[model samples]
Target: MTATDDAAAPPLDVLIAGGGYVGLSLALALKRGAPSLDVAVVDPAPAGAAARDGRASAIASAAREMLTALGVWSTLEPLAQPVEDMIVTDSRTRDPVRPVFLTFAREEGSAAPFAHMVPNGALVAALSDAADRAGVTRIAGSGVTDFETGTAFQRITLADGTTRRARLLVAADGAKSRLRALAGIQTVGWGYGQSGIVVTVKHERPHHGRAEEHFLPAGPFAILPLPDNRSSLVWTESTETADRLVAADPFTFAIELERRFGHHLGAITAEGTPRAYPLGLMIARRFVAPRFALCGDSAHAIHPVAGQGLNLGFKDAAALAESVVEAARLGSDPGSADALSRYERWRRFDTVQMGMVTDGLNRLFSNDSPALRIVRDVGLGLVDRLPGLKRRFIGAAADADPSAPRLLRGEAI
Candidate 1:
């Protein structure tokens, strides 16, 4: 439970690399889902310096449900923003082709929300608290400098030169996962010709807890609502254009963004320095290698058009943890090929399908052909008009179902 517990504690059943939201959240989920096992999280941050901030994460309803199962969602509710509705439109077209808007609101009997926007720091803090409560040991300033997968366990050499041997090695690191690379997990994908610029701006008008996707000719111009009438923006543009924009001064940057942003939120002012992340779709050829498994952005990274990138990672985490915990309950080796493959079987199709959908949508909506525009808009409107289809879409977003693993269904795995 304490930082020193990393070395003094007993050998771990799971050792997670990367202390980011995905890794920490997964560790917390595993600890809460299976208390009989010992888990240790190895992150790069220095010990006792836990009050870190400046990062942000968008937690979807599905993620909230998973966190609720881990018993960490209640503490995070205060720092979260609930998304009530979503509006979709074309930025440049005058008539906007076929207008369509979708709302993931609770019509009736729907107890879960659509999504939440939470500060990455707040979520990390909550997870740390939850991990401590679950008696999961923390290993700070200890990232894997080298990792070797043995027949029975994976051996990790940390920055401090201490070795960690675990039955299951989980890679919850970011897009460039060192553990994955060390395991020689080949990834099959390439970078997009674009980059996504993320920023939180203070708008002149209240967002009313609504999310907006202005499908501009270049890419998606999304505005996700925050708590205090502020909104987080994910503006995707060509790689060249994004580079130029981020290098621009705040005044110049806000002016250019305002022009593309229109008068939807009235006058908007930049609240922080804009950061750019290159967009891409990368899927591992295999989700697991021997005694190792991949989770979060380490397993796959996709375009954020649908804002489900992190949500999908959480799904992977929940499913992977569930698979292992369930196997443990059945007196099975959770790290074996069969058990890990079960986790893969549950996620591969869904993850790959989402990648294609988001990638295709990014390409389709970014084109300016008048015919394509009209056809896609009409398709959008059609989907919006079908109530049954709308419910299906909403249900899919929340990931609520019996076939889903108990952990993913808001039940202990």
Candidate 2:
């Protein structure tokens, strides 16, 4: 689709505010699921900018399947690194050595690995390309400035002062979504007083697709494998400590990193400038408002302890797409209260459940209480010993929820 001035553009069936992964995927999914529907995405970032974000995500098996069903996974598969095993340990930041308390290997009978570490850029690029091919319009370098919902359609005002209309409006904006706030959606959450320091490190030896999580007093530190003998570090610490570490000189920063990183992989060097983000759990009290719906971080943002945040957003996109498409197929108004309610009902409980799980895990593990530590370690050991239980845990991490939407199950809407 050729770029046209927003003023002259026709009304859209769905107008999504945000061009991140969830927004792009939702647009593509909708177009693919119901070709007759008109969809467009608006974001303040220039076109292709999101594809340059310097981060990676763990795509659970279910999310991978959804991407494959959307015909974008093949494009990303080449750059994706499958996770073959995962090890968990609990220790202090200054511990001489952290002992693994739990380990999960590739489960038998599973066609795909539990998850794949995929660069966010590659995934976004693939989805963007697919959306373009699917004839979805993208309004770049601008965002929804305001909107007025109506019975039949919602009038939208763009940041560039262009007005357009849509049957439904979606907020796939980030956790601090301006659109969501403007829609008067209240959120419930709290800051963990922790921050996640992110960086890519190149190790002398290959990781062989192993991921590790060390539960330190401050939070969990994760080393997720990337392609080319590189691994992404997600080091969690007190907010102040994280800020100080990231701002420290190269030598000091490297020293601190080494203290937590250990020598399991031999010598390591930082691959890029380190960045830190404050940790928090924010869930919108409601996922839908009038003709508007929330997807991705706009609806819920959880701790990265389980590496399921991105996958949760994908689930939201899949479920919302399926709901809207199925409604249209039934000759129902896609933006009707009944249709939006279904999407809300389908996702709210699952999202809440994940939020509670991650929150509880973070609270249980991010501490130095001796009694709590012993209890958690024992729990981890038990889970590791129980093969059936381990498989179930792995399956859950892979987004194998039985009530998953058809799109998430790799089924056509």
lDDT of candidate 1 over 1-413, digit per residue (tens): 64453334455788888777677777877777678877888888775354476545677666787888888888989888887777788647343342445445665765656778887777778877777787877888878888777787777788887787788888887789888888899999988899999988888888878888889888898888888778888999989999999999888897888777667678888787898889999999899889888988998999999888878888888888888887887877767787799989998888999899999999899878889888888877877899999888877666556676666667777
Quality of model 1 by C-alpha lDDT? 0.80
Worst 10 residues of 2 by lDDT: 1-10
Model 1 clash pairs?
none
- Count clashing residue pairs per candidate: 0, 0
Candidate whose lDDT is highest? 2
Error of 2 at 46 (Å): 0.9
Shift in Å, residue 16, candidate 1: 0.5
Q: List ranges where model 1 is wrong by over 4 Å.
A: 2-10, 47-55, 93-105, 108-112
- Supply candidate 2's per-residue lDDT for 305: 97
TM-score of each: 0.93, 0.98
